[model samples]
Target: MLDHAVQSLREHGVRMTPQRQAILEYLVTEHSHPTADDIYKALSGRFPNMSVATVYNNLRVFKEIGLVQEMNYGDASSRFDFVTSRHYHIICDTCGKVVDFNYPVLDEIEAVASQLTGFKVDRHRLEVYGTCPTCQAEQTHTH
Candidate 1:
């Protein structure tokens, strides 16, 4: 799995540094939609020289190479996902967890894009924000 991720990264003109490989591999394997800091913390113990900024830079590289997807939800931090297939994201406003989802009807939205925006839209991004099951329970109990 990680080998495929690293191979994709190298094909996209990104240097196959250990840090870059580690970050991309983690993103592909982990589904919690982790942020750069989350990754840095988990890795720093193993790699004392790894910097937080390095993690962010690697993520940016991954995004540029189309190896990773980024989601910003006004939470002051960008979330990252490694799945490259066209899909969407769900964010828990309470716990800040993100989940991946696919909508079969999303093609209709793309079909109307050219007519509505008057631009030759080739792709689009969709993200829905709400409470996850765990967060919903916490909210109900807190009330």
Candidate 2:
């Protein structure tokens, strides 16, 4: 995955710096859908001079180059996902965790919408929100 990400970045003429490499490595390995601050906190120890702004900047570049996806969960910061394939995310409302799930594409829905509105349908995203099992268990214990 790291090699593929590096190749994709190079294909887009993006430089592969140490910081960027570290950021990409973290994103590819960590499926937590971490925010920019989370990334900075995780990598700052290794790259002592790296800043949060650097993480944000690299993330922006990655998004622009189609190397990563930026997800806004109505939180303070947007989270980053490394997987570029078409998939859906299930977010835990109580714990604020994001998990990925793959489902068959809903091409019929897009076709219907395009036919009804006469507008070209590009793509769509679906996010399911609920309490994760751990959160549910915690709630049960507390109650």
Candidate 3:
């Protein structure tokens, strides 16, 4: 499926440079939301010839093509997500881990916003912040 995605990206004039391909492949298999620095670290070993700027440039292309999503949760570092579907996120305040949450209520929330605000709504992102289960467990143990 990802190969098809990459081919589609190339067809749409994405350059398809080797570095860009590597980035896309990495994103498809990664479950964790990774920052640019994280990506640079992982690729540095194999792609010593590739520059961090190249990763940023390719990420921009992926975002432009809607193949990747960039997220900023009031953090200095921006994280990148590969899952592009309409979904919400739960960000762990302790670990800074991000997980996808598919809630049907989000549609209702969008409807309410449109009804009350009288604004044309195309899309929305809902980010919930809290300690993850593992973090909560650790806190309990410590206390």
Candidate 4:
């Protein structure tokens, strides 16, 4: 996946610097859907000179090249997701943990929406929020 992403960037004429590669590698290796600040903190030990701005800029480039998607869940920071395919997110309300789940593309919803509204629907996002297992366990223990 990392190799394919690097190739895609190369085809787009984007130069692959070490910092950019590290950022991309982190995204590819970690499915945590991290924010720019999260990424900066995680990689700072290895990349002492890299700044948060560098991570943000590289993330922007990755998004532009269709290698990643930025998800804003009404949070203070946007989380970056490595593009795979059509999927939805299940978020833990208690801990703000985001997990990906797969379902068939809701083309029927788009069709119905377009028919009812007379507009072309490009895409849709679905998120389910609930307490995660760890959070549930913690709550149970507290109660």
Model 4 CA deviation exceeding 4 Å by range: none
Arranged by lDDT with the best first, the candidates are 4, 2, 3, 1
Q: How do all models score by TM-score?
A: 0.88, 0.94, 0.90, 0.94
Backbone clash count for every predicted candidate, in the order shown: 0, 0, 0, 0
lDDT by residue (41-109, candidate 2, tens digit) is 999999999999999999999999887999997844799999767889999988899999988755477
Comparing candidate 2 with candidate 3, which one achieves the higher lDDT? 2
In angstroms, the error of model 1 at 14 is 3.2
Candidate lDDT scores, in order, read 0.82, 0.91, 0.85, 0.92
lDDT of 1 by residue, 41-141 (tens): 87888789999999998988878877777778885688888866778888888778888898878968977988888888878888798889998888899
List, residue by residue over 1-143, the lDDT tens digit for candidate 3. Answer: 57876887978976677778778888888868899888999999989988889888888888887888999988458888885567888999999999987888668887899999999888888899999999999999999
The alpha-carbon lDDT assigned to residue 67 of candidate 3 equals 83
lDDT tens digits, residue span 93-133, model 4 = 88888999987756478888989999999998898999999
**Alpha-carbon runs more than 4 Å astray in model 3:** none
Which residue pairs clash in candidate 3? none
lDDT value for model 4 = 0.92
On TM-score, the leading prediction is 4
Q: Is candidate 1 or 2 superior in TM-score?
A: 2
